[model samples]
Target chain A: MQNNWEKLNQELFTSSKRVIILSHRSPDGDSVGSSFGLYHFLKKFNHHVQVITPDPVPPFIHWIPEFETAINYEKQKDESFDAIRAADIIFCLDFNTPSRMGNMEFAFDRRSKDAYVINIDHHQQPDNFAHFQISDTSASSTAQLIFDFIIKTKGKTALDAQIAQCLYAGILTDTGSFRFSSTSPHTHRVVADLLETGIDVNAIYQKIYDNYSQDRIKLLGFALKDKLKLYPEYHTAIIDLSEKELNSFQFQKGDTEGIVNFPLSISWVKMSVLLTQKDGIVKMSFRSKGNFSVNELARNHFNGGGHENASGGMSTLSMQETLKQLESILPDYKQKLDESKI
Target chain B: MQNNWEKLNQELFTSSKRVIILSHRSPDGDSVGSSFGLYHFLKKFNHHVQVITPDPVPPFIHWIPEFETAINYEKQKDESFDAIRAADIIFCLDFNTPSRMGNMEFAFDRRSKDAYVINIDHHQQPDNFAHFQISDTSASSTAQLIFDFIIKTKGKTALDAQIAQCLYAGILTDTGSFRFSSTSPHTHRVVADLLETGIDVNAIYQKIYDNYSQDRIKLLGFALKDKLKLYPEYHTAIIDLSEKELNSFQFQKGDTEGIVNFPLSISWVKMSVLLTQKDGIVKMSFRSKGNFSVNELARNHFNGGGHENASGGMSTLSMQETLKQLESILPDYKQKLDESKI
Candidate 1:
């Protein structure tokens, strides 16, 4: 499996002159980290490398080295499109499908005819968009895959503190700080190698987890106290937020990002769901422990699908109606939830 | 240093019959991790090893392997006393001074005449209590020292997953996940070695961080919203919680463990202070960024001292009076605080 990736990477880079790296929309730690990790690694070669994000990198991840250099397609459409047009090889990182690119999907599709597209991701069921596809669902994060890519192609000597810090942040956030089930011993070994590069793990943790606004934490408090709901019989928990409640806290794009996972902390909760009303649609996020399979639930009920333990969905109905839709279907999974307990 | 420690460890273990490991009162991650790491390492030899704590382990840290076996002096006094009395070798794992052992200090002192006490700690200015002292302030945690101790004596092949998990937890928590200044390149190297043991780093992190109660998070919200005070001129942030507020939240012993470190997340804040009134005395915690010395502030003004960035202090004055005291000294340290910023 690694030999194939190594051959493809070598063949693609040997003759390639200009390279543009792109991550999915609403760039997260993994997206930003993997893009920059590849960008920094490829910079050591005799080629020009550029990183472009679908949108601006979030403030929490702003401390990453050279993060400001990543061109935001949302803000600078002309420059991002120019880079996409002129690229010889384009690296699509962290996302599986072109539709996940949001507004950049058109540009990617238009330029794919001329550029050699390389899809590198950990998500399941990647689309057949790239000429060379390196996808592994078992990998903890895309950054981990990138680490293996670097080691396979350039060897361990190519790793430096800057690359290590970026990859570490990616793995740390995607594995939920090494707590997620996707994390394997190989993931830890990869992290160990990254640490050897003199990256400060704690500073990266602070930059990712602790750089939140005061109002966001306060919103978390309100969500837990006033919004959280528990269904012990079904081994499930839920937090539903209306547009007004979010506005009161002045909700930003990523304010409620990980709030859904908080309920999964309870010992008995096998599944959790978060429903937020925004932009005339009720956005839904589902998370589960063990083998409850939130992906199936999200796909069947709410027009979205992701990994087994975590998934996303959306509803065109009102917040009340969407919650009613959720309550209606939870009982069907009672047996599954009970069996998920280890 | 390695040779001396190896000799001391070999001499101490070879002739010893019963080994008892003791950590300081109000045991934390470092305390529990170091004690248990040593306990598991020594159990491999032809000797009986036991671990004891001055009080109950916090609920957040109770998921560690064999955690329930550690005798708590506060709850099981007779068993702890008997263990101390019968032991021929006592390992002082985390604390520097015997006074830090709380009520168990008497038993330690009484048994010191017959048993050989080996102190392995990573604190500044260790007391002259142990016959064989292995103290390095540069080490991230006592657990890190124990990792070195194992490598020095038995070689790296002797390390297993259980010991690695315990020591990794120790290093992870002590360095605040590797953000603290005490975290050096050597710390990362030690963690790398531990990770090579195939321990589940994510599971350990989940067990430690995601086990907090609902009230504790709510209390944090209240502390940030109602009690937090910012002195922008002095680059100081304070959280003053009265007894009533704590009672309303039904504060547990370790509820406020990391609350003081929250204000330091602000880009401009250089110093953070948490004052919580309990019984008659007001307990205080001081945290600073960069070169600011909280130890000096704690030692000179509040009758307490710890590491440079983190320190503890106490006051006999009323909560109102303590606020006045803090306010009065704000101007005196303006020059120092200004110069401390990196």
Candidate 2:
């Protein structure tokens, strides 16, 4: 990517610069991971680097090294503005356009005219918004891309345990712990290289994925115990949670994020659906394992569309009515669902 | 491991031999995956290979290539015996000693003379029974060992999707989907190489891991809902099921096998225990992550022991009493348990 390595190295990486490492708003594992992984690597090059985020790092990601030091534009506007004013180079990671920064876009627009922005992302179709970009939609995560960047620039010797753990966290979460189709052979190889740095893979996995709230776990238990209904013949499962029941568990916004995918662990379940009712509307989350496209199901029925395996929909009907409608529609897709899991 | 490559090539691998691939009793993912992976590889050399298990490859393993073709020593004694007798080279896989064959030890004992046995396993303290042995307890799984073996002998070109899937299944299961500490960097590298063969990793993962019975899932729900108790201060959780509760779920032996490990998924939980009262006694399963040693705990208090992370015990006390005792003992170990998960 560096056609003029000497010039870019001298200007961007060689000499000490006030580099601001920036990620998308509402930062996730990949964004935080890629940002700090690059941040740590840059620190080795004697760069005065400061990682900045649009929001605070969630508790699940607090285990990452120096995560608290990352300047939050929303939380510390004056400091973030000061950091932006002092920056010589800015890194746009895990997101394409500056619009992905949401309310933090103003912070980016305030960067000095001389500030050089290098984009590193895996999301498809980046906006024409950076001085240099390394975009590969095929990459499992931006963390993996950042790994390649470090190896290409400074070679494998530059990676240390801290950088490895951050990257490992990124790839592990984004790739669904190496279970998703996005996890390519190179992803595993990158993980192998990362593991060789003496990062505890098990610990990284635990820190990223295992930080569940007690109430959230209890809600999961209740959902599985009382609401889950399985249809063996149709190879389908549905779990419906009412607003009342959710309140009983003190449900928050993201409590049901993964509940729909859980039933996919059942061998016969080709398609799993979770319907959560709040504010008189039922929201549906669909997850399929093998070949059944929840995207198609969501588009053809409900006014929603997303990925092939995971999709979302909404119904104005009651949860019971929604379940009834879904059950009635199952027989039509039974043939595909029967073949989906195999 | 092959000191005399030329000799081994001529005598063991190059020439067509009636190759009998044998694994230990009660075939698991590692045993079946290793045996059949080697089975497919040996076929390239024109060796007529018959994979034999001590019993039927369980329903869970039916997805592996030629798993059904694997002669079951228990179900088809004559076929197994005949295969053993006709063998010119016996590949002992996934087991250290012949005694692990259980009742099928006779089958091994009856093998024809001049049948050179090469033992390939990862288990510790392999018996001095085979002419050649590659036992590395450090290997994550026999599947990983087999991958190394394949690469050593035939080079990367020898691996195909079938062989890759088989070995992938072995490593995936043995390493607990790459979460267990046994999963080394080399293990991930081996998987990377396997994935290079264009195997459908997602499908393989689904086939091997998603095959759960409906009753088993329901039982898991019941346990989590009605039996589980959490001690956040001690970083511990426990689930206990009485005989009546077990009966209500139509309990099977392995239904509760991994129940103790579930609580460890919560980030703060260092130790998790499952106490199931069946027949006349309460059986205890203890699992802890990070530094805590459940083996010592089990051995000290419950007269049982196993590995550092997972162990077992038995109690004459009622489920309630066992829970009380465990809760009381946890306070004494709170300091360690608090530090255990990190």
Candidate 3:
């Protein structure tokens, strides 16, 4: 994986450059963490760095250092595009293809002919978009790649608490607090190095996980109590919240996040779904355990596709209709769901 | 910490010895992990090692290698005491003091006079029970200390996948899968080294965490939905399950193990409690965040004491009266609970 990455230090980084870091749409922890982590590291080299995201990051990660500085393209298009157009070196992080950049794709294609692109991601597959790339699917998160990148180039001394905090957040969330299957020995070692930089581990965890409001948690309680539905025969569970239910909790954006994962905790549950009715549409989330392939399920029936275990979709129907539609489609996948393992 | 521990290798372990490992009563992941971990490691040196516990391990950990070899004092008292009396060296793990052994204390005091008691623990205020001891309060778990002890004595090659699995389970549970504040950089590094021994991280995690029965999760769901009561004014939450409620779900031992901790995930909840009624007794569990000291609350109000953040108690009164008594005492702790930080 190291290959010719030494050129980053020997060539590009030796000179001050206009650098813009681009991450995927609806930036998650890895997207925000890797982008900002690299942005923070590049600044020490006298480069003008801008972290441009396809959309605003979740409220849970707002405590991240300089998170406010990230340009959300959906919210701040002009600023994001300007940074993209003027880039000397574009670091596309966390995501593999420019299409993953959402609205930021055109800016990269039409305006950044003079820029050198570097792709550092842990996802599968790669296109010929980057002048330099490191695609390691075995890596737990892109933050780990950034850690290796810095250690490979400048060694461990280059990392400070700020750099370590962002990277750790990326790894921590992406690896589900180190519970996910992707977490490897190297992942823990990377976190060990990050902890050595004196990052407040508990503070970071609380800021990301426990930062929800009382109403948000209450909504969760009501949702689990009243909304969560089980299809035990199909090894499936669903939580469908109507607009009226959301309003009862004074719902805010991102409040219902992670609510979908609760059902997956059940040992026999192969698939879990969360549907929320809002703005005349029912947004859908699908998560599964083992090889049930929620992606194929979402893509085939719900007009969406994601990874095998997690996916997303939307419904232009009422919450009841969506729930009915979801229930109607489960029997076809019942055999596969039953065969899936946790 | 490594003061004169060379004697462990140069003198004590120079030849095979009859070694017996003991852990605390109602053995948790740490107790079982540390004891079995040392048991596995010591056996590699041709030592006749037996792991004797005060009770059977939780069902989740039964997958651990040779877990069937474990001698449970509650069920097999003769076997446990025979092993305890025949010991040339005693490795006291997880718990700090002899009193932690519960019914086995008298046996240790009366029968093991010639045994070289080696106390390896991570708890606070260990008594002067061992001739050779390592009581490190800062360590993530006794398993981590054992990792250090083994590495310090016999080097890394002394470890195998079985030993690593046991130790990792210890650290995984005691540190709440590395989420607790006690986890340090060294903890991760120890896990990293354990993983390097070719341990199946996912398999271990699934066996320990995902091994729950469907009924257990359903019980949890019902508890959250029908039982969880929030008292935001005092930053408290309680879930009390009556005998009828438990009967509805066919409650099993360890089913409610982590149910008390769910409310602590709420941002403002400084303390959470779980009460279970069975056989005319109301068993109480108290868990708190920051420094509110559930230990003192359990001790002074409920006739039980444990760590400051987590404790246990019992109520001979009816579940209703016990809950009423619990709620009435909250006003006195309102300020302290509010002041406690997460």
Segments in model 2 whose C-alpha atoms lie over 4 Å from true places: A1-7, A231-235, A250-255, A277-284, A296-305, A312-342, B1-7, B231-236, B241-257, B275-285, B296-306, B312-342
Residues B1-342 of candidate 3 have per-residue lDDT tens digits of 344666666545789998888889898988888888888888888888888888777888887789988888888888778888888998889888898999988678766678888899989888877878898999999999999989988899999999999999999999987878898999999999999998877778777887556677667767776688889999999999999888887888988889898777778888999999999899999998778899999999999989998999999999999999999999999989878866
Tens digit per residue, CA lDDT, model 2, B192-243:
9899989987888877767777777777777776777988888888888899
**How many clashing residue pairs are found in candidate 1?**
4
lDDT of candidate 2 at residue A21, scale 0 to 100: 91
The order of the candidates by lDDT, greatest first, is: 3, 2, 1
| lDDT tens digits, residue span B87-195, model 1 | 8889998888999999999888778467878899988888888878888988889999999989978999879988988898898888776667577767767876887
Clashing pairs in 2: none
The DockQ scores of all candidates, in the order shown, are: 0.32, 0.62, 0.53
Judged by TM-score relative to the true structure, which candidate is superior, 1 or 2? 1
Q: Rate the local accuracy (lDDT) of all candidates.
A: 0.84, 0.85, 0.86
TM-score of predicted model 3? 0.93
| DockQ sort, best first | 2, 3, 1
- Cα deviation in Å at residue A288, candidate 2? 2.5
Ranking by TM-score: 3, 1, 2
Tens-digit per-residue lDDT, A271-310, candidate 3: 8899998887999999987888999988988899989988
